[model samples]
Target: MDDHVSQAVGRPDLVRLDERLICLRFETMKVLSADAAVAHLLSTGAVRRGDTLLDSSSGIYAYALALACHRHGLRCHIVGSTTVDAAVRTQLAVLGAHLEQMPPSADLKLDQNRRVARIRALLAQDPRLHWMRQYHDEVHHLGYRSVARTVAAELGNQALTLVGGVGSGASTGALAGYLRRDAPGTRLVGVQPFGSVTFGSEHVSDPEIIIAGIGSSIPFGNVVHSRYDVVHWTGFAAALSGSVDLLRRHAVFAGLSTGAAYLAARWERRRDPGRTVVVIAADTGHRYVDTVFARHDEALPIESLAPHEVTGTDGPALPWSRTEWAGAPAPPAARVSPEDTVAPVTR
Candidate 1:
């Protein structure tokens, strides 16, 4: 953890904070959603030089909207969920963004309404507030598509056997579009919470995926309608533990959603060992300190993932798959040159 993260979460670093490679995705995968928000804010004339703008989103959306509003000299008021990390909240707040808490309501336990209601309350109090409805808006796709393009570019002709997530349908949808063009060999995969009706299933699965920011009770046209190849299910605790172990071993700090993708990736890899599997670790694990880092995470009742070596599995409708690499093996110590050096060892 960085000093800022330590201060934000108000904990002395007993263990050094390690940020793992975590599949940077690519430079292109970076900065999804902000550009669109900026353009929309200007084009819609939804904000003025000194007016306050209202945004309802999780971490990524909040960060993007705050940046857009800030650039235009408009104050942004963001209402975020408790599931959002303290570090993310702190960063946005430090950027001069005002944050309002979203209390969990009886009917809105998993519904994003508590935050929406807060934003609505802010708007009710002031007419100058422009609400950026990200859930239904197409502009949000701008950034999401960018991420998808980046993911596709990262594949670089390699076969992508699986891809999927629950929340922010825009991100997954855009990736679907990009993969459809660039990585033609790529396969699409999606996951949903067991009872989620939006992803097109109401049959409450035995062990529903519990990662926050993914899975919904409502059907999302943006996600469900995409050209998906397959859909699978995972338990929350299982995915959570998987993410934690990923951090501990691979030194990869991924958010729960990313972990879910990893679980899917492993499942796909099992169907074919030679296939190149790409996992989209959408967000960092710093957002999950409350749970993974702690002996316990109170955010959700789901279980964390467990460590297991990747092994091939046989099945008809495997999570996902593609053809193996076609070639031969170079035996015993192929020529080595000084130019074929590892990273510069200063020591």
Candidate 2:
């Protein structure tokens, strides 16, 4: 029934996981933004068929942009992070997208920096190429309008709370922005990994990983700090337990970021039983099988895990922490001029 595979992949399934909690699951979440961005660019004459689109991605967005390019008859050139796995690389290759993956690095900041540097270099060499600034551009936010409508229609007038990873500010941020237009009381809770600079948790590093794709080491221009009503900073161990428990209890196989969001969602629902909490599962568990699911035995009991409540960024500590964001401005580390979110002209 769809014109392109991207349409099917980008469409999410809303599944009720509990009496007051639901899961908004996606195949490859970035496909929604990629397809919409490409379509808008074509309509506005910023790009055309056979032209190349360039962007930097860690993993999810690379495959997403590749699919969008395939569907739209455009070329995709991805400056990928070291986190991009072999499976994603193969998919990108098969889809005819060009990938320049960075060398392996454990430090996320270095990996992100390397990808951005490569993108800049590529843009300098080819002014004809359009950069899909997934982390910086507001155009990416345009895609979630329909998704918000879907949520509003399906959930139907209950006091709503949306919980998801604050990735690039396009998914969770955009959805909350759209959902709030009609229902002004809709609450937005952002999930972050311990080391993400986006929400000022960078001071405390998670020993395992930052739950990649959910959190960022560098500041993302698209992240509007004021949108969040609450923020949860989760570590690798806590998120792993959440993912393992989610599969065991709810039969939902989702990624690391989803686990973090699920953990936060459960807590929020417990505190506010009257509100319906929707957790965003951005992708499936396939990519995280070896890293997270395989370590299921190491997962702790979810009932035993509770976040350390903090009033401010400095108070966040340990495996999990929660803070009342309460419409605060961007933290000092992530403060960027509003214009940074604007898409730049092709260099």
Candidate 3:
């Protein structure tokens, strides 16, 4: 029998929305990362058959890890954030993955901190458990190489602009790096929520901003700031509006992060009508039916801002920002078993 699920994880649809804009729908992008991480550990003998894989996630990564563990015949454990919903909880259970969800907190930073703390406690309890540091570890970047190669092969030698939400930085940053190797003129545009601190945006306490799976309140080591040519801090209203517009216009049922990317792609298209803009659609909209779709009418009207229209005073300067970390070295690889002598995986 064919392993359809394993085969389907990384091969998402590359769709063309218009002459200038395209969408890379990675509904199972995290699954690809999890598979690569697990495969690396196995190939390096970092883990044995009976060992357990562990990690901290908001939602998608946990589900991905669970699926990966199931395929590899390993146990899985997750320290999930408060944002994890009932559906995800059920999926984890079905996958035979243990989950410990953090208590509800309005602040995402606090939630992440608590999840990390819990993961540490869990790690202390078991020597056989391996932590897959999705946020900081570079191994996660290996999973996106195929996606980048696919983009390069499909659009050969074209001046391209890659747009997506910058989370752990693994997905967008890694893809940008790979694509640029073949097409050096490829521009990278990272989209972040208004309240996120990832791209040096001012921190605001807005419970109303419910967009997850994209922006982060804390720093992510995988995010390479220098790889980005432009950054856009999208507000909740703008993201919600974009999500709605995607459903209405393109019939693309995507999540808030996808909406933010779509909005940024539109701006990019307007900025340079000649360049081909590709947006990464990370996930679908089924998980957001109640919070996003049900509350669509309440979304505030957003006047699309041109690249120059965005002012720096509110956050980082529009189009460009002084956010690059000077002389920042690459983060150390995740600790592996002493006996495991394999070199770190690279794209």
Candidate 4:
């Protein structure tokens, strides 16, 4: 990658189309100390001294929460899937948080439910254990709300179409809330992996997704009367194609969620006879380097990208199977150009 363009892409200045993407990059320009996460938890009553907090998270949030618990003199333990990367596990251990892993293979429903069940069992066994369940935690909901405020503020000067993925529905839901309160007219749209039942609907889907990351089978976010305008669905292949397009065009590397939202945003620009659609690139794709975008022989195969599992329905693949995601079929990839896939034209 050209260092000059790579450094400049984050500026949100060089990019073209849809009123320039704005992000909550306070941590990008400067590192946010653990104090920030700690303060947010303490002030929200989410954490207390001598409390034993147990939580499940993807690596990043787990790392952040562990740090916060450490700072507040709390005993923290985490339950992570065995699929958690080895490196992430090391980091969690280094952070001084006790770790436990989930069982081997099961349908994602079985996998995740088993993990949650384990957490619930552990919580039941120990009265001192405080489950830091983001699903129900208002403060957990607040993390994305704070970021949404930044997105709203940045776009204050122009009309906006908002985009992002739903993991536990917190981020997108919170952003929708903040936008409604602040930018009442801004359109808030969410992107979900096609098979993810997160905000169940048959509209705007791509192919397949399991991803263990964003997008949930269940709806998240309290509806303060229709906070979100629409939830666009994206398939895994489309998301991968989108992620590749972002790298080629905008010089931004982000995860599949980024790819999913990126394509949705471009679709908004293409389909919506409107101006200024803004999508969140969430985080750079550095972590995904080893997974989705890895070398052909080493990375997950394309067949995984396509839907694989069928539930009780009489169909090849589950008819709109919302239970779990089997990756998508990989296409014989070629040059990621604007003609092949849509992306910012700035490059």
Q: Estimate each model's TM-score.
A: 0.67, 0.98, 0.87, 0.71
The candidates, ranked best first by lDDT, are: 2, 3, 4, 1
Those runs of model 2 whose alpha carbons end farther than 4 Å from true positions after fitting are 337-342
**Model 1, runs deviating above 4 Å:** 1-31, 43-51, 104-111, 118-127, 152-154, 183-185, 200-209, 219-221, 272-274, 296-347
Writing each residue's lDDT as its tens digit, candidate 3 over 140-215 gives 9888888888888888778999988888888889889988887888888888765566655544444466467677
Question: Scored by CA lDDT, what does every candidate get?
Answer: 0.52, 0.91, 0.76, 0.53
TM-score of 3: 0.87
Question: Which lDDT value does model 4 have at 269?
Answer: 59
Error of 3 at 225 (Å): 1.1
- Pick out the ten consecutive residues of candidate 2 with the lowest summed lDDT: 338-347
Report the Cα lDDT for residue 63, model 3.
88
- Point out the worst 10-residue segment of candidate 4 by lDDT: 326-335
Question: Which is the leading candidate under lDDT?
Answer: 2
Candidate 1 per-residue lDDT over residues 104-193, each given as its tens digit: 532323546466557666766775666665654555666555555555555466566545574656666565666667666566666544
Question: Which model scores highest in TM-score?
Answer: 2
C-alpha lDDT of residue 105 in model 4: 55
Instruction: Mark the regions of model 4 whose C-alpha exceeds 4 Å error after superposition.
Output: 1-41, 44-46, 201-209, 218-225, 295-347
Model 3 CA deviation exceeding 4 Å by range: 1-4, 299-347
